[model samples]
Target chain A: MEYKVQVIVKPLDAIANPEGKAVERALAALSFDRVTKVRAGKVINFTLEADHPEKARSITEEICQKLLVNPVMEYSEIQISQSGN
Target chain B: MDPIIKIVTFPGTNCEYDVLKQLNFLGADAELIWHQESDLGSCSGIVLPGGFAHGDYLRPGAIARFSPIMEQVIKFAESGGPVIGICNGFQVLTECGLLPGALSKNDRMRFICKTVSCVVKTSGSVLTSAAVAGQTLHLPINHGEGNYVCDEETLKYLRENNLAVLTYTEDVNGSVEQIAGISNKAGNVVGLMPHPERATDPLLGSTDGQVLLRSFIEASK
Candidate 1:
């Protein structure tokens, strides 16, 4: 089976996101007053082949822990779904 | 035998020559090591010079940390070899978990390029062994992501272990506790955002960097 995985990496809440603040200021200057908060992160999409869904999730989680996300500064949310075989 | 210091160069690394010249002037054999080659040869020390490695994609040092040569670098650090990372090299060291904490974008989000004064916080670490604690050194820092961030536990550990080596007398960036540099638990590896090699020559305006570079060279020997 093939699984579609999306890993979203974001700076930890305790850490300041300067880029996000810049974007927020730009938007506010443009009169987007409704947008009160802004944060920035990256999304990584990949396909994983595994015999079981559990296996795919486990592998993706491992990848996130080891490489996709830096534990010191960022955290990641992994979403996995069954992909067409 | 003369100690050989190897400067590891990634594709975008531009500071190897500066480090090489400084090390050579200090009477050490300095060689440039390619990022793809794993062999460390007989070098006694390693210097990861500054630059945007692999275009700083995904984050500075995130991609470069996986370079084939890094395996040997990790081994070198583990074996108690003197390894120092300057600027982007420091980012790479943190990404590889050889050093603690992470360097984030500067608080104001501007690229900072200026000579700043740093207080030597620890005299026992490999990077500061030659400098007296509380003494100031002027070094140039050029980077966007120089603000260091870490968890509370990590911060406590650093203070308890005396791993924080260099600290800005004032806040240059919003680095936690103004930490400018730190070493691993073993003290064999160190990472800092300043360009010590650039300040080694008196013509560059300050020779304060020589104090630390001299310390590193002596440790390597």
Candidate 2:
């Protein structure tokens, strides 16, 4: 089966998100003062072939641990779904 | 025999030649090794020079960490061979887990390019073996994501072990404790955001980088 994987990577909460802060400041300057916080992150999407959904989830998690995310500073959430071939 | 220092170059790396020229001038046989080569071939030392490796895609060094040459680099580092990663190379080391912490976007979110004063906090690593603690050196830093960050536990460990090698005299990039560079626990692998190779010439405004590079060469031998 083919699975579509989307990995969302964000700096850990303990880590300072400079880009997010900058965006927040820009928003405030643009009169969007109600915003309290903004955290910036990236989304990585890919397709993979796996035997089952569980296998695809494990594979995506492994990829996130090994390459997509730096555990020291960033955390990742993996979303896997069946991809129509 | 002159120690052979291999400077690993990823597709977008631009500082290998600078490192090569400086090492050669300092009495080492420095050579460039492409990222796809799986073997280091009897290298005495390894260097990952500065540049926008893989165009800094998917974060700096994230993609380059998977390069074929990194396997050998990791092995060489494990065997206590000297390895230094400057600038983008430093980012790669952290990504590959050779070093702790990560270099994030500068606090002000701007790319910085200037010579900054750095204090040698420890002389125990390959990159600082020739210097003494408290000694100050001027080196150039050029990067957008030079601000280094890590968890509290890792920061404490780095402090307790004296693995933080170089620190900015001032908060140049908002790095934790103003740390500009750090070494692995074994001290064979070191990473820093400053460009020591670019500062090796008197004509370039500072030759202080020679002290660090010389230390690396001596360690290689």
Candidate 3:
């Protein structure tokens, strides 16, 4: 099975996001036109052999908790896909 | 009893020797302490040096804070023994819950390296005991995650209690209140982004940082 994880690393609610603010500024300057908010994040994709979809999700979740993202400022969204056999 | 300080070393820390050297030059016996050690029985104070611990894998100081030695550090601070965190160590202190708030990435989105002026907003901390209100000193700071952030109410409280130890003279980073360093309420623990030990010699063209180390010496006695 192959999995794709999109990690959304943003400042906490109480924290300020200057990176996002800068991107927003650039968006307005470059005239991307309708872009209102610009936030940056990371996307990770990997392949793993698993018994089932639930098992894959569990293992990936553990990786996310341990290393895939920093819970303090980032959150991870995982998607699993089966390869053509 | 002469005071002995221990400089805690995480896997990626580069400044333990710098801290040990400076403290030793100041007439204190300083030793390197490995991160896995649990007992802190031999020292009067502990220093967490600056560097990219755990290769800054997750976040600066995020994984480093959970090491076994930090358990002892928290206990030592709770017992009122002084702890000083510099640069990356400061990030660890905040991550380990020994200090309030966190060091976000620089608002400028760049790593800033230079001597910036810091004003002494509070003078009673062990780290700033030699300073006076409104006094300014030039210190070198090098880091991307040097922005200090706290909740609005907490920020107000820190200001009220004069816990802001070092504040930048101008907005170099997007740090709230331009905070360069801060101390806990009890004032026994301090964490700062600048490298004071790096500035403590005349050969370095700035000895204004000597007072900070001098203040630590005075506190241990």
Clashes of each: 0, 0, 0
For candidate 3, write residues B80-197 as lDDT tens digits: 9889999999999988888887788888678999989999888888899988879989999999989887777778889888899999999988899899999999888999999999
Off by over 4 Å in 3: A1-7, A13-36, A43-85, B1-3
The residue pairs that clash in candidate 3, if any, are none
Scoring only the second chain, what is candidate 3's TM-score? 0.97
Pairs that clash in candidate 2: none
User: What do the candidate models score in CA lDDT, each in turn?
Assistant: 0.91, 0.92, 0.83
Could you give the CAPRI-style class of model 2?
medium
Alpha-carbon deviation at A77 in model 1, angstroms = 1.3
Per-residue C-alpha lDDT of model 2 across residues B1-221, encoded as one tens digit per residue: 54489999999999999999999989888899999999888799999999999999988999999999999999999889999999999999999989988998888778899999999998999999999999999999999999999889999999999999999999987899999999999999999999998888899999999999999999998
- Give TM per candidate: 0.95, 0.95, 0.83
lDDT of 1 at A24: 92
**Per-prediction DockQ:** 0.77, 0.72, 0.30
Model 1 residue A74 lDDT score: 89
Instruction: Sort all candidates by DockQ, best to worst.
Output: 1, 2, 3
